[model samples]
Target chain A: MSDLRSGSNLEKVLKAGHFAFTGECGPPKGANLEHLKEKFMPLKDIVDAVNITDNQTAVVRMSSWAASTILIQNGLEPNFQMVCRDRNRLAIQSDILGVYAMGVRNMLCLSGDHQSFGNHPQAKNVYDIDSMQLIALVKKMRDEGKFMNDEEIDGPPRLFIGAASNPFADPFEFRVYRLAMKIAAGADFIQTQCIYNMKKFREFMKMAVDMGLHEKCHILAGVTPMKSVGMAQYMAKSVPGMDVPEALIQRLRDAGKGKVAEEGIKFAIEQIEEFKEMEGVAGVHLMAIEWEHRVPEIAERAGMLPRPKI
Target chain B: MIVANPKPISEILDMIKDLKKILILGCKGCVTVCNVGGAKEVGILASTLKIARIKGGNPVDITERTLERQCDPEYIAQVKDIVHDFDGVISMACGVGPQFLSEAYPKQRFFPAVDTTFFGGAVQHGIWAERCAGCGTCIIHYFDGMCPIARCSKSLMNGPCGGSAGGKCEISKDVDCIWDMIVRKKMEQGRLDDLVRFKPSKDWRTARDGGPRRSIREELVI
Candidate 1:
């Protein structure tokens, strides 16, 4: 009924301080093995964990399992993402066990992008179970030591399960409420959708405090810097439920043309500084997108220096 | 087959309002293939609506059920006894299914769970590409089994547009140029020259721009 092992790694990370570092990388489209090795090397010592996106935005990418295998082989921590849209219960449960064997210790369960949102608009979404049910299923697998098929695992995964939350997108009151359900379903930590409004995020933190969720789960605020004004507009309009505050827009606007990259880093660091003081805010997940090199600068500026000792 | 479109959670929650007895209906037909109306969708929609409604201070009684087919009269007849038990019926079927259900049971108020999108067939495992425009015309023989009107990005009668690069559409790297597939198919079948043959511009009258199109055959009517 309880997962002492699931929370053990996260517990160690959380105790290091109220500050931590995480990053996300969208897997390349092709199956080039060198691409995997190249992507993980830059990420190894820099991040506490690196997230391997599974066919993000519905574009065809290498399987997260295969990519994670390479990451684990390279002695890097892989935060594997598994979406319910592509597989059924049979495949999901089996894959969870298989990935554990490959030494992928962290997982982020998601409902996934609608097929309509993906490049393949016509693909079927096999949401055999929603993210909540999948979370519960994983927890059940860990606690009971059996999969959905009622088969016993040789060694159940010591998975530090994480779930996603889009505070900017979900209704203000409901966002924290939904996150509470994810925590209740056994999400060890929360990796939010891209964070744009630090002021609004502070308000969300206040609400999380009110709901007692701040005490219950580790919250990793997500930040992805905008590459251009065009990209900022694209994220605001195209990414469903993503909010880009006027201050951020104005900062980029004031930075003028071609200087938006500089403005984006400034904005992200500002968010990181603000996030530092919030109680129960476990850490920050900095998704540099393609520009991972700028991460050390952002972390240095945010005062998240020195690798977290866990 | 029942085909229904997904409605936003807010919209569905609004429809239920203060209704205590709610039934979430699902169709295991075209809607299932489309991922909008099915047993799984019914469960998800029901759970989401329940959570949202409960949070909004109005408690709702939610029960989910899915039928093999919604349009068929036999399946429609099965829900009659149970229809009166719920305050309202949320029909997760094609536009036609709910209309038929309403016609069959005039006493019950029916609400459609899904918005009907289109009539199409599955192009791949999860992707269903539109094939027929319901224009009441058949041109499969002329185009060598490829429907330019439906599949072509630009609806080009003769294509392989300059925009196509490496079989990907120029509009976005994601979309496959349907014409590219056609050309490759034609060449594979030794009919590359067949595409060059003159075919007049498509008649607009047959398409929706002219008016609604219909087909009737007296011999099949009996």
Candidate 2:
């Protein structure tokens, strides 16, 4: 069972022809399980895996380690997130080892947001190690058998390390370079920032293939549905670097106010289809954000059903 | 605050490749105030250097120690024992610290890891710009409070230059033209004629080109 669990999830996702689904499990602001368990109950069978975000947006969400353990104990595969925003070398090193001891193996390492972007703007940020260094730190523990503090773990966690990329926002040339750095730092898989344009997505994939990353690591396409016409406009305008094309905006506008949700779902399904057909796209990560219940329907419309076996 | 462009980290690390033992020395004086050689910056630079060494297959034994001021005689004396143990020392201080450290410990090689940026005053929190060039002359009375000599792109003596486009310097679109700001301030105060008044030519005898600059007070010396 341990060996099976340790295998690359990307392999399983790719072997399954239908689009693979993933969703976020935002940790509540508090520690109580009452709100969390109720939320996990609905996401269990719908998603291939649910990621427990670590202080997402740096607003002090529930501990990702605890949330992942709870979800894992309840029979849901939880992808634990670990950010380098608030922790130094000692904390980061210990947390990676400590979470592994709890039997939660899959991990996503992130640089996290600068505190200015969060609700608590005055909070100090500890970018002690950036995202690339975080990835390298984990790889050092797993591959070189040493932690950041130069301490040897009894047995390193056989974690399926993942990193994030923002092809949509970062410079086109530098985006590929950054992903290459992440891969070199031992990212077994990658989940990109929210994607809106299929053409740009395809170009990004092509660049990955050019860098020989397609064969080395799995690439997961990120898709988020527009909740309303107002939300779509806000995302395009307010969100830095997320360029939702004018045509898609028109489509949403023409669909009228009442059918916006339905139109958004259809657009998401189109993205899932496009992602599945693209060469070297290992899987798709569907981020419902606050709208978790609509994921099952979105998955069904994308013709993606859970295929448990390879 | 002596200005010098320190070598990049990768280059410095490569220069000390042959050394098995490395000491990272940080100055908590000017470098600390400037946010370069502080405790946080020292830790980060040390970690990067260690990682670079380990990954590069050298795997050095690196030690990090920070002193109050690396340029002073007493501070340099305090690190003498620590300096004898290391094959090389990477100083995270401004330009003066490395030379001082080298002069104190001639046996140990020294390298600087931070580029001493400038001699300036704090404009805001974590923001500093070049104000005084350490020239022996004080010319503040001529240009109100603003230092047109240092802040202006052209360093024009009389008034605003034509290179000011939309309040930004023509040389670089990102930076603001200091001369334009000065003109606006003068006009707002109804002293625009002051901009055209004759100003004595700057005395170069007190500048760096003159010789080694020095300052002393007779009462303080006694």
Candidate 3:
């Protein structure tokens, strides 16, 4: 409706009516440019855009803003992620302008993992604003060309704003309303938390469709292929709000030791196929966490290769 | 009430170990109600310090005193006559006590015996949890009297942020996901639409972000 908010590659692909596919790559713990490039290079031509995680899992890493700039230099479009865990409104607004000046056009705002889960448990958290407010703030800066205080901005960042949704979290019925709230707050797209419970996700999507949320913004279902039985078990038991079903774990275990990774990819491909046809799913966010090298293979097998050259 | 926990005995001992004569001052305020700082605790701490000093062969003179409220200037003035007799003082009140004492008696050294934790009430016999951040703005009426500012790990005004599961926070199982409770309460009351409304970014200028806070009541002022 607004002629491409940021004119980003991901926005172009989605607007072109193609089943969009995106990948994720976390920055290295330190400034290892070669390693960072190698980690995300596999996704360069295979996915619509690469999401550079912002200190994902609350573990310290190179700043996402710097990493996103590096990706842009390496001939890749970066979906720069900014978390509300570490920065106040002052720093948040400043970094937004800085990254935008550095050529970042896409941003994913998140209420990051709490500090207690990270290396610095004693660190003070600065959730000066939540993800909902961050979405509205970004929208205001782009649309109204104003800061949070209503001050005029010299050059507002035209970011294609994205917000994360978790359909599997508790108080099940409220999750859809929360998604509506995010959409109302000016989220251009939604990338959900990794989905393992298909039944639950389908129900959540039905509600969203009923509310006609999909017509308002792009919805990309999140999928992370399980690397091992232990990984599946860990996500099922340890990760909060993750809805890894017991049957999915059994499928990984049944894959047997040497074949689980391939089976995991197979499952992911199947999910992608279903998402392509799903009513409200506009795309699939393939988060090949620590498995970036296999993204090309997953994309090819999922029939998402030859990414649209919009 | 202001909740606090006692500092380690070893740390308390290290604080007064260098002093020849010290006073262990307690407050009959929130610290007394919480049982960390009171007449009984002051006496016990004094005896423990004397025994520890005697065992270490540094036998020192000690005095124990309990004020009605160490935060008030009138109560703090009660110690003006004899406060200088001691080389230092160990205040068993909340963090405010030692600072007030130091402010009232600038020439004397005052050490805090307990680490002030949060503004909360005892949920049970011996357990307490944070209930308010004292953000200088109160919005608990919007969430069934629950304060997400103090309870939610991220202080998300619109929340249950993806990490909430089974009514518990992602930080720990012991912590309740206040957002979950808030949503459930709203749902039960058929007021879920209230939560559906978007809450804008909180103006934190009213909170500690504005710097050290001060409150005034002109009607009560003489």
Candidate 4:
């Protein structure tokens, strides 16, 4: 619909009038490259781009850049996720260039999960720049080839900047406005936190559409397939900004023993189908966290497969 | 005001172990308000230290004193007359008290008895909550009086950063997610437009990120 400025496959797919599909992969806690690639093996042909998480949930992990570089070596495009919790503006800007030089085109800027949630709760946080400013910082870097200090870069890292939105977070009415803010800050795409509250998500999407945010940026609904009834209960209770409704938990419980994952996938398929026609939704971001093997089945069942090739 | 907690008695005992005599100085300012290093706390700490030292086969003579404010030079000067009576001073005010006392009496060693946690006010009588980070620049007007810089564990301006669950922070169930509060405040005030655009990167230079900051009021200066 517009000139492909970001040049990311995820961007390309969305721009070319195709509903995009993205997957996620967290770098392992240790630097085991073979283990990393084995995880990506299932995701290689399953989705258009893989979101390489940076210390996801604030747990210490192998760097997203390192994991993404390996993914690139395996021929899978990566959506590099950079969080603002551990790094300040300087490290963030430097890493942007480093990851881009290493062939990471898709970038997701996030205000990372707090360090307290991770193994390093004693670690001093460096949230010198939040996600909103990070979005602007990237916009400045990409459009003007400049740093946050108004300094110029030699060869600007042309990255497809993405941001995260949690529609389930409190004050539901403001979630759409926050998404609008991220878009206004120059996000090319958005991947939300996992969804189980479709009713709330729809209301959020309706507001986003009302604000014409979908016209501005690609919004991908995050879906995490509940592997079991226990997983559903855990997400419903523990996960932050995740709105796993009790009914969904009940449905997962009703799935009985081995069929829970499929039930969760079926629910995801339903969400994807609704998102396919939903006014503001551009795609679904399948976050089968530690369950990468199910991506192919989930994608195929959701009718997102034969992963739209340009 | 600075809210702080008293250091563990074990740590305090370790700090003053070798000293046979020490002063337990308290501040009537923030520490007093926070119920940490107040006059009442000074007596308790002095008694505790007395017992801990006696048990360790080294009885320490502890003199308890409470100043108007340990952070003020004038209040610190009040201790000058009796300063040499002890080998060292265990200042029970927040981290600032020890430093101030140390600066005033360079020869007398000062150990911080309380851990300075945050610039906050009292939520309840015994409960103190962090409300300000002393980031130098104030933007609380934007968030309906809630300061994300101080309250949010991450100090996120564009937040509810995915880890906020049921109005609680991901770090702990005890902490109320400030962004959640801000959002609710905005919605209550019907000011959704306030958050509709990209809030620019915080000018951290104005914050503690710039370095040790100082505010000089020209008119108030002598």
What's every prediction's RMSD, in angstroms? Answer: 24.3, 21.3, 0.9, 1.9
State the lDDT at A310 in candidate 4: 81
Candidate closest to the true structure, highest lDDT:
3
lDDT of 1 by residue, B4-67 (tens): 4687777777777857888878888888888888899999988888888879888788888998
Cα lDDT tens digits for candidate 2, A1-310: 1233345343355434435567778878898797888777677777777878888866887899999989888987778898766886779888888888887767888866545556787776554555667777787898778876677878887777888887765334445656776786778778887888778888889998987887777788988998788888987765655668878888899999699889988999898888888887778888888887777778777887664544
TM-scores of the candidates are: 0.59, 0.60, 0.99, 0.95
True contacts kept of each: 0.00, 0.00, 0.82, 0.81
Q: For candidate 1, write residues A38-151 as lDDT tens digits.
A: 666776667788888988877888999888888878877788999877987779988999998888778898877646656888875565566766776787788788876668
For B1-222, candidate 3 gives per-residue lDDT tens digits of 999999998998898878999988999999999989999999888888899899999998989899999889999999999999999999999988998999999999999999999999999999988999999889998888999999999999989899999999999999999999999999999998898888877888789999998888999889
lDDT of 1 at A147: 74
Candidate 4 ranges beyond 4 A from true positions? B217-222
Model 1 reaches what TM-score against the true structure?
A: 0.59
The per-model DockQ list reads 0.02, 0.02, 0.89, 0.70
Between candidates 2 and 4, the DockQ winner: 4
Write candidate 4's Cα lDDT for A100-200 as tens digits. 89988999998888887789888999988888888888889999999888898999989898999988876666677778888988999999988888888
Highest TM-score: which candidate?
3
Better of 2 and 4 by TM-score: 4
| lDDT (C-alpha) at residue B108 in model 1 | 79
lDDT (tens digit, per residue) of candidate 3 on A74-162: 88999999999999999999999999999998999999999999998889999999999999999999999999999999999999999
Which residue pairs clash within candidate 1? A122-B126, A122-B127, A122-B128, A123-B126, A123-B127, A124-B126
